[model samples]
Structures are given as C-alpha cells and as structure tokens.
Target chain A: MNTVVRNEKYWLMAAGYIGAIFLWYASVKWLPISSFNRLPDPLSVIREWLSPDPSYGISIFTSDYYVHIWYSTYRAFTAFFLAVLLGVPLGIFMGWNAKFREFSGALVGLLRPIPPLAWVPLAILLFPGVEPAVIFVTFLVAFFATTMNTLVGVRSIDEDYFRAARCLGASRTDILRDVIVPGALPHIFTGLQIAMGAAWFSLVAGEMIAAQYGLGYVIWEAYNLIQYPTIVIGMATLGIVGFLSSAAIRWVGQRLMQWREESLGLGG
Target chain B: MEQVMKRDRGSNNSEGLAPRPEFGKLSIRNAGKTYDPQGSAVVAVHDCSIEIEAGDFVAIVGPSGCGKSTLMNVLAGFDNVTSGEVYLDDSLLASPRQAPSPGADRVVVFQNGALFPWKTVLENVTYGLLKTNAMSRASAEEKAKDFLSRCGGLDKVMRSYPAQLSSGMQRRVEIVRALVNEPRILLLDEPFRAMDTISKTTMHQHLLKMYSTCRRTIVFITHDLEEAIYLSDKVIVMTTRPGTVKLELTVPLPRPRTPEMTASVEYMDLKKEAIESVHEEAKKAFERGERELA
Candidate 1:
C-alpha cells in the first residue's frame, strides 16, 4: 500500500513537470502576445540544447557550453565549501558562547539584511579581480545562511541533553562533540540546503554583473546577441544543476543521520 | 527467567561489575530557590529540607506546580539553591555561593527520556562509562549489553535509536543507561510519567529488580501518590508554591515488592496518609490559582 502511494507520488511529480513544459510550449506557440513570439518555443530550445553542431555557437555538444557549466559549478561549489567550513564552526561558537555571540552578532546583524546582489560593488573593491569578487559575493550569502542556521540549530537542542551529557561526566569538549554537533546537525543540513541555493543565486548575479565565463554569462550574452534558445538552455541547466547540488547535500545528510532517517521511515 | 537468573549470578561473581560503594547520603538544609533575582523575584522552593540515606529509594510527591521539580534540579546540580546547602555524604553539592557541576556520581534519568536520539541504544547506555573513562570501549560495550539484557531484554534493540523504541522501552533504556554508569545517586524526575498503565507496571517490575540488585541511592520525583507509596522507601510531600515538605511517611514494606502489595492494608494506609497531605496542599494551590485569576 505504501509503495503504491509512493509510486503514485512519483507519477504525479513527473506529470507536474510535463504539464509545465506543455503549458510553456502552448503559450509560446498559440499566445497572441508579441513577447511570446520573441521568446523561443520549448521544442526549439530543447532541439538547440541537444544539437551536435548548433546555430548561435553554444550547445551540449560544444566545448564552450561545458566551459560555462564548469566555471559556474566551480565558483558555486568553492563558495559553498568555504561557507560550510567557516560558517559551521562560527555558528557553533556563536551559539555556545554568550560573549562571542554578542561580539559577532553585531556584525552579522549589520550585514545580513543587505541583499547578495548589493555586495557586488563592495566585493569588487575588497577583492583584486572579477573572479575573486564574484566568488566573495557568492560566499557571503551562503556563509550567513549556514552560520545563522547552525546557530539556531545549536540553540534548538534541548537543555536536558546538555544536563544529561554533563551528568554522564562529559567534558566541555565531549559535550560539544557528542551533544552540540550531533544535536544541531539536522538544522545545519537545513542551513546547507538554503546556503547552496543562496550560493547559486549570488553566483549567477555576480556572474551576470562582473564575470565573463559562466552559465549566468551565457544567459546574458545570449540575451545581448538574441540567441533566445541559448538563454532558455542556460536557465534549464541552472535549475537542474542547482537541484542536483542541493540533492547531494541532502543525500550526505541522510547518510550521516541514519538514526533520524530510520525514525522518519525515509528508507523504505 | 533463566537469562535473568544467570545474569544476576554473573554480576554477583564479577568483582569489577560489583555494586558501587554506598556513599550517596543526600542532605538538604533549608534550600530555597527564587527565580529572576533582579526584578519580580518568584520563589519556587522555600525552606525545603530532606535527608536520604544511602541505598534508600526516596520519592518526592506534591501537587502540580508545587516546586517538586525545582527541588529535584537542585539535587541534580542543574540549579543551585538561593539559600542553604545540599550535601552528598561529606562533600558539598550545591549552595547559594557555590555552583555545582553535574558529574558521573549523580546521574539523572530525566522524565522526557534524555537518551541521545542520534546514538544507538547500546551507545547511549555506554556513554557515561566511556565519558568518565570508567571502562575501556570493549568492556563498556560488554557491560552495556549485560545491563540492557537485564533491563527486561533491551539487548535485541541494542542497535536501534531511542526514537525507534516504545515509551516503555525508552524509559527502561534511560534507567539502564544511568545504572550502567554506577552513579552514587540516581535522580529520576517523574521518570515514568505519561506511560500507559501496562508499560508503567512492567517498568515498575524492572526498576524494582534493578534496585534489588544494585541498592544504589535513588531520588524519585512524582505527583502520583500511589506510585510514591509503591516505589519508595519514604515519601515526602511538598506544599504548593514556595514549597516545603508538608509531610514525610515511611514505608516498611518488604524488599522484592510485588504489585500485589499495592492492594495490601499497609500500602492502602500509607497511600491514604500521602493522599490527605497532598490533597490539602492541592486545595491551597487551587485557591491560589483562583485568587490570581480573580
């Protein structure tokens, strides 16, 4: 019975995507709007994406397409990796210590509300080059997301766990390792998913504004050159890649948190 | 039954696994706790004093909001008293000036089941022993399995997380986790609250069996009078807000007590005494609530 429901859910999910694609195709082909005519139809975009030797240069078969994908993936991944490395520890300490939280919280409060796109000018000024600037701006958004989520994760842990740990003769280090880290992990992973999305968001914005070799650049370049299908291809690729990256984080989280997954019955 | 008998014999024969030294006499002298010291201070417990001898199972019973939990926190070293002192045998545990740190010697089986959900049942049980460096990893696992099996057969779910177990099983695991550490004093804050009747009964049997084998000091906190009478050597009733001991009743029931004892004349007499004392306090608390509403 459970498997039947799950299979039905999978079918529904597939139908949703297919329905959206059909709607896109219908709107572009049949709509009277001039904007719809200007926009490439879904069929043509898919054809251009799959073509071995495509018009207007970039396609799945072209080296330039992979180059754009690699650059965007590299930038987004580097920022995300750095964010997790720094943000997780900083978040742990922020939640753990009152004095440290007070000191760092002031800077975090000052910076957090500013949109990621707004950081482009300051990032360019702070870093020496476009590559560093784009990466820096992307890193900031993911860092705040990861750090804040991690801090909240640590705080969300029950006081009894701490009491139990201490009563069990756990040292400060042991408490941090055994209680704080594991307890906050669910939230940390939640933060990571958000951080990954934010990283992609800021990376694309940075790429469009400052950098020259990424999927964001491809979309902007295609727009300028009127390669309409390439723009759609860039967007579709970003959506798929962004989803895959977040899925990877979730996959790792599920592996590490088997106790939680099993309890949730996510395995079956 | 054969497994239980063999396990009992095994523990008796092992020198390393023998019961711990009896040094957990807890004495509280005029302990008081007032929350929010700076403004609008609310006294939770006032002039609460009790004496618990080593190897005695003492239960603190009171009406809801009677500061029973506040007193337990002081004994557990989670909070300190605003006045007076709490002593464990010779050493000071808590006071107005001296803050106490929770240690392996005083393990708490929290009412909400504090078994680390991330850890397997075996890991949770072995945690204290590992943390205190009381046993090597191999021996800790061995000892944990031994206690798990003894606690009504928890050995089968050794690899499972706390979330996978029933409330009764989780409660048993928590108790065994505390017992495995060989703490001088085992503090249970309404450890079996909210369990179904059948599970609660089974738990009582397991707890009594463990108590008989180990004979460690236990401080149980509950609002259930009958539970107080059945499980404890002495029941201390606390009055409502700014709570203090209203009455202390001793139970001279024989060891290895059975559920049948709850129906006996002596048990009923003791339960009657506890109920009257608690009812009087509950009436006062209800009146206070009504007055506040007014």
Candidate 2:
C-alpha cells in the first residue's frame, strides 16, 4: 500500500519531462526569446523526424534514421564486447596474482590515463581503415573502465570468504570458481555498467572524428548543413540509444546477481 | 543412529582413492606467535603448550588481547606458530616455518558465525560437504535438512539467506556446516560473544545438546567465566597478552548439564577460580596500557 504513494512520483517525473519540452517549445515559438526565438521549434523537429524532407534531411519515415542508429549500435556493442573479453580476465588476474599484477600493472597504469581521444590519431595510423580506428578508440575507452573496475572488485572481496572456502577443503580451482567468482560478481556487473556508458561516450567522439555512417556522423553533417532540427534529431536518437544500451547492461547485471538482490531483500 | 559419520572403507591407495580416516590427538608443544607489523615486535602468545585428548571438550578462558584466537588459528592450521610445533596423532601438523592449509579435518567457527551471506541457510550448511566431496549432492542436501531439523526451528528457514535470519540462526547454520563434515576438532573462537542474553542462552543449550550427541573434540574460547564453566569438561585459563595457560581446572559437574546446575555450588567455585585467575593478569594489562599512554 505504501508503494502506491512511493510510485505516484512517476507521474511527477513524466510531468517534469513534458514541462521542459513545453518550455523549449514556448520559449522558441511563442515568447520570442532573443537567442531561442530563431531556434527550431519542438513541433517542427517532430514533424521533420516523422516525414520526408530531402532538402532538409532524412526523418523517421526514411531508412537513413535506422541506418545511422544501427551503425552506432553495432560499433558500440562490438567494441564493448571485445573490451569485456580482454579486460575482465586481465583485471581478475592482475588482482589475484602478485607477479602478474606487477608485470601488467605498469603498462595499464601508463595507458589508462591517456584520454580515449588522444588514441584517435595513433589508432587511425595503425588500423587499416577509419572504421577500425573508431572501433579501436571505443574499445580502448570501455576496456580501461572495465579493467580498472573489475580489478577493484576482485581486490575488494572479503578475505574471510577465501579463508572460509579454504576451511571447507576447497581446491584452488574450487576456490576460484565458488569463492572468488561469486564474490567478485557484484563488482564485475558494476564495471559492466560503467563500461557500457564509456563505450557509448567514446563511440560518439570516435564517429565524429572519423566514420562513414553513424549518428555522430549524421549530427556533424547536419551541423555543417545548418539543418538544426536534424541535428537535434541525431542527438535525441543518440540519447535514446545510449540510455537503452546502459539499461540493457544493468538488466543483465541484475539477473546475474539475483542472489545478492534476494539476500538484500530487494524483491524482483 | 549414533549421530556420527563412519570412516569410508573399500578404497585403494595406489589408484589415488584413499578412504577418509579418523583424525585424533592434537598436541601443541611450546607454540608461540609474534607479530612485527612495523619493525617493533608485539608478542601475542609465548610458549603455549597443551595436549587435547581425542573427543575431549576443552574450553580456554582469558581476558581480552590474550592471543586466544591467535592460538586457535595456529591450531586450525590457518597460521604458523613462531616457535615450537603442533601435531595431530603421530603427524606433525605445523612448525615454526611450516603450516598446513586449513582443511575439512579441522574447521573453525568464528565469532558472529561468518556464514556466507550470499548463500541460503541450507546451502551454507551443505557447503562443507560439497567442498570436501564427502557426499553426493543429493546426500548432502538430505543431511543438511536432517541436521537443520534436529537442531530445531530451522526447517522453515532452509531457503532463507543469512541476512533474512537472526544472528542466532546464522550461528546455528555455521555449526551445522562444521558438524556435517564430521571434523576431528572444532575450534570455536568466542562463538557466542555477539548474541543477546536470550539468544546466548539458547545457543549454549543448543551447543550442549550437539556436543553430547556428537562427542567431537571441541576447543571453545570465551571471556565469560560462567559460560566457560557451564559448557566445558575442562577449562584452561590464560594470562594477558603473551598469553600462556595459567591454570587448568576440571569441572566435576555431571553431563546433560541443565540451567539448574548453573546454581550449584561446584559451578560457583569453578567460576570463582576463573575470575581470580583472570583478575591479576587483566589488572597487569590495564596498568601496562596506562603506563604506555603516560
């Protein structure tokens, strides 16, 4: 019954978003505010997004919208998957093994601090093509986030869990599987969420610099053409795509860590 | 049913299939531990020696900071003694430089019952059996459920996680986990220290019941004199930091000890001896702390 009161806040959330869009509409179209007056109206942005305007840009009705969205999605997911494949195991090893930690820690520490954008020039020079270069930049961004987070996760598991496992007569393999993996899982999922966000952030930057087809490319093109409504459309599409991807990662994390969730008494 | 596990039989050693053998007779000879965290040495235990007969219940009582838990760690093979040796029957278990890894043969139940929070109560209980590969998965589950029921009031909580149960229930689950393995020696480091009065009494009763039925060798450490007197067959008192046994008292109180026996004169005399033995050492420790501060 108390959840009813707690849940009513969702209406206010909807109202707040709708109010902001309304304010954006009113300031530009009705109030004639100086800078915003010349800006694109919300209605025109929606109208342009739904129907064709070859002179202006492609809208939701055309295949161009999907092409850009799909392109961005593909690049982001591919980069993120590759980063996870390499980073999670590397991070776990770095945390668990002293010799491995000392050896790889130096390389990771030096490379992790360099901005993802700084890698762009080198990636472009090293890779065979621009697409590969962009993907590499995106992968680098996600990889650093994931590796550091996973390492922290592995390091943070309570020492008692390991001791408890040892007391149970668990072999080294058993301890790694039962104690270390499950103990580190909650942190790994947290890393995955952060990695997803970093992946999208880098994907846009990489695409803006060098990409044949993507939402970032579309946004840059619209800016060059002074297609203001189309620019807003590209941004809105990016926001939705990024949000959906992050939400998907969180969903998977929650499912995998349902044991934790259940123990914490957070109902599914 | 004797409420005890039988030794595994019909196994060939050449094929790497040795049936489990019964462990016995723990002996510690001049065991000591010292820590030097930042160059200065801090003695925790000094020349501690005790022999634990097979299946005997021994309780060690001392003031705080007396290295009781440290000694338990060395006994459980979680850490190596800085001096002397520990043995199980004829085999040397640990020495100054060598410590065996903690195994199913000796398990320690820590203060506050450190059962895995992520696991359900039954899962936690069955964990030891599964880890040692002592029983089939199906058999482990059945044994865990049976133990849970025999302990009483835990049948309904089998599916509940540690956080879902009270601390007392968690303690019970931890005990069940250790007992299911049929360990040779169970080292309980102040297991009842965190419980409330009602829960503590309940736990003591539960422990007494389990101890009588199973008759496994147990070493319990505590600060409570009355608790020590009530639960133990023999009580060993230790001096303050750099702890070594000061006195060993055998309780004449007979078995299936009840709440009523706690009021008996014998109980009071033993409690008095425990208090007297600890008082001098505790005062010395207090004065040393004061002098250091000054």
lDDT of 1 by residue, A170-230 (tens): 9999999999999999999999999999999989999999988999999999999999999
| Model 1: residues with Cα > 4 Å off, grouped in runs | B1-21
Query: What's the fnat for candidate 2, on a 0 to 1 scale?
Result: 0.58
- All candidates' TM-scores? 0.94, 0.91
Model 2 DockQ, alpha carbons vs. true complex? 0.46
RMSD of each: 4.8, 6.3
A103 in model 1: Cα distance from truth in Å?
A: 2.7
Predicted structure with the largest lDDT when compared to the true one: 1
Kindly report which residue stretches of model 2 are placed more than 4 angstroms away from their true locations once superposed: A30-33, A52-55, B1-23, B36-39
Q: In order, what fnat does every candidate score?
A: 0.86, 0.58
TM-score of chain A of 1: 0.98
Q: Please give, for residues B111-201, the per-residue lDDT of candidate 1 as tens digits.
A: 8889999999999999999999757999999999998887678999999999898888898899999999888899999988988788888
Clashes of each: 0, 0
